[model samples]
Target: MAEVEDLLEGVTVRLSAAEEIRAKGRRRRARGRAVRVGAGGAALLAAAGAWMLLPPGDRGTRQTVATATANPFRTDGVIQMPRADELPGYARWHWTESAGLPAGAGRRSGPLPQVGLAEACPASFAMTDEPGQERYSLLYTGRDHALAQYRVIAYDDTATARSQVAKVREQMTECGLRAVPPTARESEEGSRAWSGTVQDGRTMRVTVRRWNSWVSVAEVLDGTPAD
Candidate 1:
């Protein structure tokens, strides 16, 4: 009976060793699959990153994303003036024969000269052409033969525009100009504006507005007294 017990123990030990070898083989296969899956995942992430870093083409939809997201009120660091043709009616107005006033005519020190029909401060105007300052102006005539002036002035930033607008307002007040209440229909394009009637015999609707980096002034004669 002792010999039989010893033989059974040896057989049991052999079976256990075979099972251990099979288990090690299964573990190795599972580890190999895990490593392969990890490598595949890493490759996918690398490919995605590479695609994200690709440059956008000139005509690609992404090319306009920056412009679309940009603020319209922002100045492009270039002096921009509204064109005479951009007036209310394309055919109702025509450009004057003259090239318009000098560059610095809008400055406080350089008032616009009283040209034949044009008056100084036809519309309240302020601008600077110092090293970093920029401004532009355009003049037009409506079908009724009334003079219309448009001015665009750029500043270092929105804060500067605001300060400049205030200064112009103070100057206008000191000049004894009368303020006209702006109509609710007036559009300022997300900017600060002051509208008034300059009591110079002929009624004029003058507007001064300030946006992100620009100040714009427009004046139109009402063709009547402001009584």
Candidate 2:
């Protein structure tokens, strides 16, 4: 009888030890899991902060940003204008040989079309005629006598392009023109546009967009209503 009691006590002690070990193991596993979860949360927060600091173009994973190094017209010599096919789609367009920059002239100076702005046009933001600058100009006259004049200017850097865009916007606001939604396609590079009618009963649309190293400006004057 005494031997039987001793064996039973040994079994009870072994069972208690086993239970204690299992409890310790469970506690260790719980701690490890908690640690992993905390690390994951911290990583997620860091990633979100980094994304917020990125530029507008970089925040969108699908878009490409234009850089000055990618500009194709940054040469020191004269850059030819884009071909007709390269220009934006219009009902019809034809190149005017007499309206472009003069031979060997890098830049041109002229009065900006009176678009009913309160402030006078700034000469620096006006069209550039520097050598090695890529520029194109054309007039599209529809059958209805509505005319649209388009000009595209390519800058060497995005800073210059953005500065010019800001100036255009300021001019439009000073002129008391109404702001309208942009109809132009979203650019992977960067873009700004303004459209409104002047007091002269003519509507004007200006779009400044950048692609790679090129900044293009399109000025459309329509006798018809705003589209």
Q: Which candidate is the best by lDDT?
A: 1
Candidate 2 residue-wise lDDT at 75:
51
The true-versus-predicted C-alpha distance at residue 150 of model 1, in Å, is: 1.4
Best by the TM-score measure: 2
User: Tens digits of per-residue lDDT for model 2 on 113-142?
Assistant: 222211122233345434334455554444
Candidate 1 TM-score over all chains jointly: 0.44
Worst 10 residues of 2 by lDDT: 111-120
User: Which segments of candidate 1 are over 4 A away from where they belong?
Assistant: 1-98, 101-117, 121-131, 143-145, 178-185, 191-199, 222-227
lDDT of 1 by residue, 31-142 (tens): 9999999999999999988877776553454655555554443458555555666543335445452355333333222222111123434343434434245656666655
TM-score of each: 0.44, 0.49
lDDT score for residue 107 of model 1: 23
Each candidate structure's count of clashing pairs: 0, 5
